[model samples]
Target: MGGSGDLDAQLRAAMFAHLARVSAAHPDGVPSDVINSFRFADAPMRLIVQPGIRKPAQLDAALTIRTTWTPPGAAAPYADEVGPDGSLRYKWRGTDPNHPDNRALREAMRRQAPLAYFYPVARGVYQAIYPVYLVDEDQSAHEFGVDLGQYPNDEDDSAETPLDRRYTRRLTLQRLHQVLFRPKVLRAYESRCALCRLRHAPLLDAAHILPDHHPHGEPVVPNGLAMCKIHHAAYDADIIGIRPDRVVEVRQDILTEIDGPMLRHGLQEMHGAKMFLPRSGRDHPDPERLEERYVQFRAA
Candidate 1:
C-alpha cells in the first residue's frame, strides 16, 4: 500500500509538470488531467510512469499511447482496426526517427511516468484503448503497430488460414468492445441488473441488446444493459424479452413450465416487471433498437 501510494504521488507530479508546460503555451489553461491536443504532433498522449523503483533497470520510461480519434462530426477511419497481436493502430505522422521533435518527445516520455487518462471521444462518451509506446521516428508502418509481444490467442484455430484470422479478428474486436462497453453500461445502470435487479458485480455482464455483428448494433451505452450472467444468457438465447416500453416478458413456454427455484425466482417471476433504466433519458435503451431485438425474442 505504501509503495503504491508513493508511486501514485510520483505519477501525479510528472503529470502536473506536463500540464504546466502545456498551459504556458496555450491561451486557455489546460486541465491537469487533460492533455492539450494541440501540444502533441498527433494527439495528446498520456504516459504511464512508474518512478518508485530504486533500480534503473526496473524503470519503464516510455509514454504509453492507447487511443486516437477523429475530430467531432468526422467518421472514425480507425474503427475496428487492431493488429492481429491486439495492438492499436494510432495514426501519428511524426514517427520519422530523424525528427528532433520525436527525439525530444521520446526523452520526455522516458523521464515522466505519465498516467493513463480517459480520452473523451464525443460528448458524454469516453473509452479506453489498447496500450502502446513510441519506438522511433522511423516513418515505418511498423511504428504505428508496436509489438506488445504475442498474447495467447484465445481462439484456438490449428490452421493459420484466412478463416482463422477472421475468427481471431472478430474475437479481438469483441474483447475490445467489452472493455469499453461494460463500464459504460454498468455506470448507466448504477451497477444493478436491468431485468433482475441483481447488484453483484461478479455475477453481472454488460449485455448487448443487439448482437455486435448486427448492422445497427454499436458499442454505445444505449445499446447495452447491465444484466446478471444468467439473465444475460437467457436474453441472448431469446428466452427473455425486453419490450420497447421497458417491460420484461419471459417466453410463454418458460413461464408456464414447472421448474425449480432457479427458473421461478430467477426468471419467471420477473415477467411483466418494468426494466430498470438509466436515470438520463438519452442514455435509456433506444426504443427502436429494443423493438428490433424484441422481434427475435417474440419469434423464439
Candidate 2:
C-alpha cells in the first residue's frame, strides 16, 4: 500500500509538471489533441475524461473534474454554480451519491488531495486549473465544493469565519472572471494587438474598454481589445487612447516627447493609425464603452 501511494504521488507530480509545460507553451488554452496525448511512463492516462469526473485505475482518488462551456442564452447540461462560501459547486455525476465516481471524489476530499480542473475556453480547448482542493460536499445540492484560489495549507476550513469565507468568495469570483475573459477576448481579435498588430500571444492582453468596476463594464468580447503589453499599459495610463472611429491617438505629451526608437515608432508612429478590429462585427469594441473610456483619456 505504501509503495502504491508513493507511486501515485510521483505520477501526480509528473502529470502536473507536464501540464505546466503545455500550459506555458499554449497560454490561450490547450487543444483537445494535446490534452489527449498526455501519457504516463508509456501508459495511457487521459487528463480529462468525457464523463466529466476521471478516476484513473492507478489512483484511488479522482484525478480531474471538467466543466464544458455553454453558449450565451443556452442552458448548460450540468450547471456548475458558485456556492455561498465562494467555492465551486460541481454537481455529482448522477443522482446516486455512492456511485464510483462520486466515491472517488469523496475520497479525494477526505484525504485532502489536490486535483485538476479543466475549464473550457472554446469548443475543444480548455484552461487547466490545477491542484484544486475539494473542501466539502453538499448532500442536498448533490455537489462537491471546490476551492480554486487556495490550498489546504492556506487556511483551516474548519476554523474559517463568515468574513473569511466572504473574502475568499470575492477573490475566487474575480479569478474566474479573468480566466474566462482573457481567452475569449484574445480569440475574438485573432490573438494580435489591436494597436500595432503584434501577433505573439504571450505579449498580448485583453484590455477592457470600460473598467471592470464600472456599472456598464462587462467582460464581453465587444467590450474588449486585444493589446500587447506596452499598448495595454499606454491605454490604461492615458498615454494613448482609441477614438470611437477606431483611430489610435497618442497623448499630446507622448507625441511630442523626444525619446528613443521605441517612443518614435511604437507610440508616435501609431497616431492616426486605424485600430485592427475583430473579424466579426459583433466582437468589435463597444462604441459606447470606447467613448466613455476616451472621455477619461481626454481628461487625463
Candidate 3:
C-alpha cells in the first residue's frame, strides 16, 4: 500500500511528537520500552533523541520518544513507528546488511544521512542550554532562573549571558568545597603555585597555613598558600618559606651535607627570589594569614 507526496513528513511529525511527550512526562528521560517501540532509525542506523538534564526533576509521566526506519530509494523513505494510541510497547529490526531485509531502510537513511546531532525545542530542556540554567537558578540574583538568552520564554524578564552564568556557578561551587581557607586563598593565588607559577587551576592547591591536625581555627586566605604538591610539603616542613618581602628561605637545618644539584641549584639559588604575585588587587594574599601559616612552617 502507498500514499503520495506527504507520507514522510507525516511520519516525522508523529515521531517528534512522541519524543516530546516522553520527555515532558518522565523528566528522567524516555524509557527503553518507549524508545524501542518506535522503531525509529534507518534499518542500518540507530537514531534516538533525549532531553538535556542537569538536576533531575520529578516527572509524573513517561517521556515521549520517536523512532523511524527509512526505506531505500532515490528519496529515502521514512516510516513512522509510533502511533498516538499511547501503547508504550513495540519492537523493530533494520534490514540485514546483506539480506536485503533492511536494504530499503538503509537506502532511505543514506539519502538523509546527515542529521543534526541535537535540535533545540524552546519549550524543552536542551543539553548545552540546561547547564547554564542550572547555574542561574542556583545563584540568588537570578532566583527565577532561565535559559542562556538564546530563546525567550513567556515568563522571562530579560536575557542571559553564558559566561556570566558559568563564572557565578564556578565561584559558588568553589565556595562550597571543603578547601576551608578563605576562598581568597584560591583567588589570591590566581590558581597558580606561588613558587613555580603552575597555572592550571585544578593542579594548584591552597595549602593550610597551619597543619590540618593542628587545633587551628577556621581558614583564612593569608594562612594559606597557593602551592603545587612538591612546594607545599617543602614549605610546610620548613624546607622552605617565603619572607614578607618576597625572599625565599631555606632552613639552616636543611643546609647540612646536601651535594645534589637539585638541592643546590633549586633551593639555595631560589633563596631571595620573589614569590609570584596575584594579578589583581583583591587577590593579594593576606599578610596576617601568611604570619599564621608561618608558625608551623618555622617550627620544622
Question: How do all models score by TM-score?
Answer: 0.55, 0.89, 0.39
Ranking by lDDT: 2, 1, 3
Every candidate's lDDT: 0.58, 0.85, 0.43
Span of 10 residues, lowest total lDDT, candidate 1: 49-58
Could you tally the backbone clashes for each prediction?
Answer: 6, 0, 22
Quality of model 3 by C-alpha lDDT: 0.43
> How well is each residue in 1-300 modelled by candidate 3, as lDDT tens digits?
135214444444445555556544432223344433444333321233332110111111111222222222334223222222211111113323432322322333333211111112112322111111211111122111222212233244245466654554344333322322423465567567788777665555677756545565335554567887777778867888776665577787666647888677656666667888767545555565566555555776
lDDT tens digits, residue span 1-300, model 1: 667546544554554565445534421112324442322223443342221011212133333333443564678643424655554443342446545333433443344333332333333233423232322222464233232223333354345786765655565556555556776677678778988787765567888888778987888888998899999999999999999999999999999999799999999998999999889787799899999999999988
**Relative to the unseen true structure, what is the Cα RMSD of model 1?**
11.0
What is the alpha-carbon lDDT of model 1 when measured against the actual structure? 0.58
Predicted candidate 2 versus true structure: per-residue lDDT over 1-300, tens digit per residue: 999788778887887887888877767778867876788888868888777898888889988889977875689999798877666788898889989999999988887777888888877888888878787788888998887755656448668888977888667767777777887888888889999999998889999889888998877788899999999999999999999999999999998899999999899999999999888788899898889899999999
Quick one: best TM-score, which candidate? Answer: 2
Ranking by TM-score: 2, 1, 3
Q: What is the lDDT for 236 in model 3?
A: 65
